[model samples]
Target: MNIRITGTGSYIPEVITKNADFDNHEFLNPDGTGFPQDNKTIIEKFKAITGIEERRYLEENLNTSDMAILAAERALENSGIDPETLDYIIVAHNYGDIKHQSFQSDTVPSIATRVKHKLRIKNPKSVGYDILFGCPGWIEGLIQAQAFIKAGMAKKCLVIGAEALSRIVDKHDRDSMIFSDGAGAVVLEETEEDGGILSHESGTFAFNEAHYIHFAKSNKTEAPDDLRYIKMNGRKIYEFALIHVPSAMKTCLENSGKSITDLKKIFIHQANEKMDEAIVKRFYKLHKMEMPKNIMPMSIKELGNSSVATIPTLYDLVLHNKIDEQKLEKGDVVMFASVGAGMNVNAMVYQH
Candidate 1:
């Protein structure tokens, strides 16, 4: 019944888009006039708040499945496991394969199936599917893999989170700066020891769903006709994370029979550096303990928000010591937490 992540891999697109790359002219007023703030001022304010300087975007011809396959291949190699041995392949994503300049998405065959095909997985028993759990999709996939292993339904599984968000994002919207594309994957296998994944918790607050990110048209008359873009109520999401995310992590730790004092690191969703910091600080405060600096590692400054890909990618970085000044040792207790669209929040406790 024991489950552990044996290997991790991630692939970020080579194209880097900096905050300053956004043009002020794109954000026009209702009357087709320019916005008050110049591009420089907007970039500064955005970086000051989100702590993001740049993010990667998939190549024009790339798709979510392509990134997922690349990451999965690396993970399989890293784990020393053959693709034929995998019993399940779970992909976490909201948008499937989306072509450039097209609003349509392909989801019928599922991105997991495409990933399986690209990886040349021949085992008929290795089922592939997708999960839609908002930004917590990747962590949710991990939770599902744990369930499968615990149920004796599978011995090995591949969990991947990939997104080609850049294709769907409306460049004219400022929120587009926070969306990017990347893929991260982990190979999970049955373990004899009780250490790996200890506990997990996930839920949704339907009332807040309307306030978070959603596809909608621009309110300005001058905006492109019939174009949909990602829109968000920043204040609402910030408040939701500050209140709900910490509570979810605390509950997860408590469920695992562990406490903040027992944790070595907290890998949070790379949504916003400031929001993540606040969430962790508030979580520790609830236990009447001061938040430890460096406990919560973040990559939002360079990776932006790739939704479900954030946790696994960050985990892979820390495991390989790619994260500056941060590394995970064997038997270390770590927690993961993420909150976003779906008004969904999730947390998991794992022993390294």
Candidate 2:
């Protein structure tokens, strides 16, 4: 029996925030020191490096779970599967439901349970849960689904990655520009198809990299210390991903018995454009080959980094022809990889 992604869906927030929107904002360093350069110059530098000119923000009335539910509904509809038949619903998120202008994260009932409830899945057998593995959460959830299906614990699962980073980011920090809100989901189930998940890898390097990403006081020194927002050492993360992510992808692809020449596409975490390009370049280098043209699909240019939602959203877009000149054909071998908070990293090889 093969475990396959039967359907996929994504929710890209309607709010479009262009870089020009931040032209008048006060940007500050983590040390609370003001940059000598003007905001326009700073934003231009940011755009040059991250290749992000715009991103999406969730509406104030909706929460992370709402986005998950929307994506899940579309996934279910695409799969044409009865909700009652699902054996599991797993949601991956970092900050939970943060109401508009609210500083607190609400995760009491778990995002997965909230999504299941909102999706109106009434079957008691359909267990719901959430995993907080940073940006890699969705891919990890898919790996877990594969295990459950292979172990005979479940045959059908709904895995979702959603985030409302706009609700949790510190406006004063430059990193805030890299974050946006979005959600993506997939239905994984048993199938007799010839190809599905072939191999996967996961790792965590918390001994020294633990604090690479964490919540702390806003970059604005005058802000109350009692309230904190997402923070990260961007340089360290870029260097770390460059050295590690490519190797992980290589291992996953090799384990799948697929050659370097066989890879048709790669769905990498939409963290940064230069970093992603560098990582994929090194992966090809490892195999003693040059990186293939258009081997990777990127949504970060428009959607920004919506944490776990990146890969699935990109995949859904490509599969639906929403992205120009990017599509997956049957029997195409693709790789999914991500690295994020928890200082975590994961990769998976899949065949369509």
Please list the C-alpha lDDT of all candidates, in the order they appear.
Answer: 0.88, 0.94
RMSD of each: 1.7, 0.6
True-structure lDDT of candidate 1: 0.88
Task: Tell me the RMSD of model 2 versus the true structure.
Answer: 0.6
User: Which model scores highest in TM-score?
Assistant: 2
TM-score of each: 0.96, 0.99
Give the distance in Å from residue 86's predicted Cα in candidate 2 to where it truly belongs.
0.6
TM-score of 2: 0.99
Best by lDDT: 2
Query: Per-residue CA lDDT of candidate 1, range 47-109, in tens?
Result: 998999999998988889999999999899999998999999999999899887788889979
Worst 10 residues of 2 by lDDT: 113-122
Question: Model 2 residue 6 lDDT?
Answer: 95
Clashes within 3 Å, all models in order = 0, 0
* Model 2 C-alpha lDDT per residue in residues 1-352, reported as the tens digit of each score: 9999999999999999999999988889888999999999999999999999999999889999999999999999999999899999999999999999899899999999998888777899999999999999999999999999999999999999999999989999999999999999999999999999999999998998999999999989999989989999998999999888998998898899998898999999999999999999999999899999899999988999999999999999999999988988999999999999989999999999
